[model samples]
Target: MARRGQYAKGAAKRAEILAVALDVVAELGTRKASNREIAARVGLTQPGLMHYFSTREELFLEVLRARDERDHERFHSPQRGFQSFLDVIAHNASVPGLVRLYVEYSAEATLEGHPARAFFEERFVWVRALMTEAVRHDQAVELMGPDVDIPYVVDLVIAAADGLQVQWLLDPSIDMADRLARLWQGVRETSWPAVAT
Candidate 1:
């Protein structure tokens, strides 16, 4: 019982630390954020924080994961389709730090042997699959044209979203939400070409 209590306390402390780290990253950006700063905010010395997270990358990864969880809850909907995805992208425009964190880790995680490589690999695969499923669902219900090529359309939507995020990061004036909505609208309008049975 005592051991379980200790573990529970540790988990709570880790969550507290991650919460502060998120705010720190948002204020300073991922490049400028540091473990020392996070530790200070959590009332711990650098070494003390390291006891909870062995390295800065681990802490950053945890922070990213927490942000993903919050975003997922905010965006995920039971009646999902293209419009739901657009809504999520619109939400992202308001949280540039979370977007920046994802972009940075995604690039860095591509390097062989990086600790975060696996996490990003799984995330990409999962998101691509989810979008693909969403597209198929739309087609099944006649929300999309049966003539639509599922694989091609799925890849195009995901690619555009990812590319637009980078562009938005570089220039906040780009209006990522509007651009994505327009792209989806074009897809919907042109995707409905009649197919003869």
Candidate 2:
């Protein structure tokens, strides 16, 4: 937490620095991005970068936090719909470079004592739980078929999304968004109840 005097300005600068770090990571990839390079790219001095993110760890953590923020925003948007899910997939695919960083970091975060250990754990938990709830909501509204197992189906959806991201990162030629939509259509069709005799 920040002190009162440091609230607005300091936090805003910190967020700005983090935003610049995202671009740096996207452009240079995670392993090659350094504080000096990030600072120079963002029009900040090295010390200025340090002022916002005291260490490389802090900058990296901010990147992880940004993922959570992006998901939360998309989930909460008033205009959210099935199209939003497609949009999220398409949007991420458009920035294939950043998606690659996410895939690499997610893989490394599973290691013992990794700095992002708790972050990734909490992130997966929240996202999976959120997807389950989304399924429930869609079900009650008749948007999702009640015959489908909500929890299990949610797990499948989220897992497939993550798995597709991994493959897409490895080979951009793969039509991940098309694959996801096809998967969605198949599942949605499963939800449609059998016609009465």
Candidate 3:
């Protein structure tokens, strides 16, 4: 019983650390949110905080994961179709720091053996599935045509969204959400050739 209580406390502390780290990253941007700073805010020494996470990369990756969880709760709904995605894009505009963190971390995670590589790979698969479902939902309700190539549409949407994030980081004036919405609109309105089996 005592061991179980200690495990519960450890899990709770880890969660609190992740939550604080998320707020720090969201407010300071990844470049500014150092491990020391995050540790200070969480009332732990840097090494003490390291006890909760295996590595610096793991902690930062957990911050991104926490952000995803919040975004999923706030913006995603299977029945909402593409509009839910747009909502997330719009919301991202308000949190440029988190967007910057995502862009940088995702790029770094592309390298072999990077701690975040598996997380990003799984995340992309999950995102693709979610977007595919949204596209199919739209087609069922006539928002998009039945002729639409689901795989192509899903890939294109993901590419555009990821590209727009980089462009938006470079130029704050660029309306990422608006541009993505327009792209999605064009995609839905156009008749796509059926894919060969």
Candidate 4:
């Protein structure tokens, strides 16, 4: 019984730490948001904050995970189809700091044995599945053609979105959401049939 109470308290503190860290990252970007600053904001000493997270990388990973959870709740719905994805992309433009964090962390995660490698791996699979389902929903409603290649379209959409994030970070004028929407429009209108044998 006592252990359960301690666990609950620990969970609550972790949640509070994550919430403060998210705000710090959003405001300061990953480069500027030092662990000291985050710890201070959360009323914890640096060592105390480290007690909650195994390492600095793990803390950053958790921040990204928290962002994903919030976005999923806000923008994902089976009935909304691809529009939900578009909405999320559009919303990202407003959070440049988080975008930078995601881009930098994801790049780092590609290296072997990186702590975030598995997180990115799982995230890719989950996102692909989500986007595939959205594409199917669009096709079922005649928003997209039956001939649309679900797997190819899903992969393309994910690639485009990820690429756009990089481009948008370089040039804010890129309009990630609008560009993706246009790409989606083209994908929807075209009938992709097998070419020559």
Best by TM-score: 4
Runs with alpha carbons beyond 4 Å of true place in candidate 1: 194-197
Ranking by lDDT: 4, 3, 1, 2
Query: Per-model C-alpha lDDT, please?
Result: 0.82, 0.74, 0.88, 0.90
Question: Which candidate gets the maximum lDDT versus the true structure?
Answer: 4
1-197 in candidate 1: lDDT tens per residue? 99999999999999999989888887777777787788889999999999999987898898888876776777766467666677778877777777888888888999999999999878777777778767776777777777877778777888899889999999998987788778766776778975689
TM-score of each candidate structure, all chains considered together: 0.88, 0.81, 0.93, 0.94
Q: Looking at model 4, which ten-residue stretch has the lowest summed lDDT? A: 187-196
* Candidate 3 vs candidate 4, TM-score winner: 4
| Root-mean-square deviation of candidate 1 | 2.4
lDDT of model 4 at residue 15? 98
lDDT of 3 by residue, 21-78 (tens): 8888878887788889988988999889989997877888888899889999999988
Model 2, TM vs. native: 0.81
Write candidate 4's Cα lDDT for 1-197 as tens digits: 99999999999999999989988888889889898999999899999999999787888899999999999999899998888999999989988889998999999999999888999999999999999898889888888778777889888999999999999999999989889889988887785454579
Question: Candidate 4 regions off by >4 Å?
Answer: 192-197
- Backbone clash tally for model 2? 0
Candidate 2 global CA lDDT score: 0.74
lDDT tens readout by residue for model 2, 40-76: 8778899988887777866887786885586568645
Instruction: Give, for candidate 1, the lowest lDDT window spanning 10 residues.
Output: 76-85
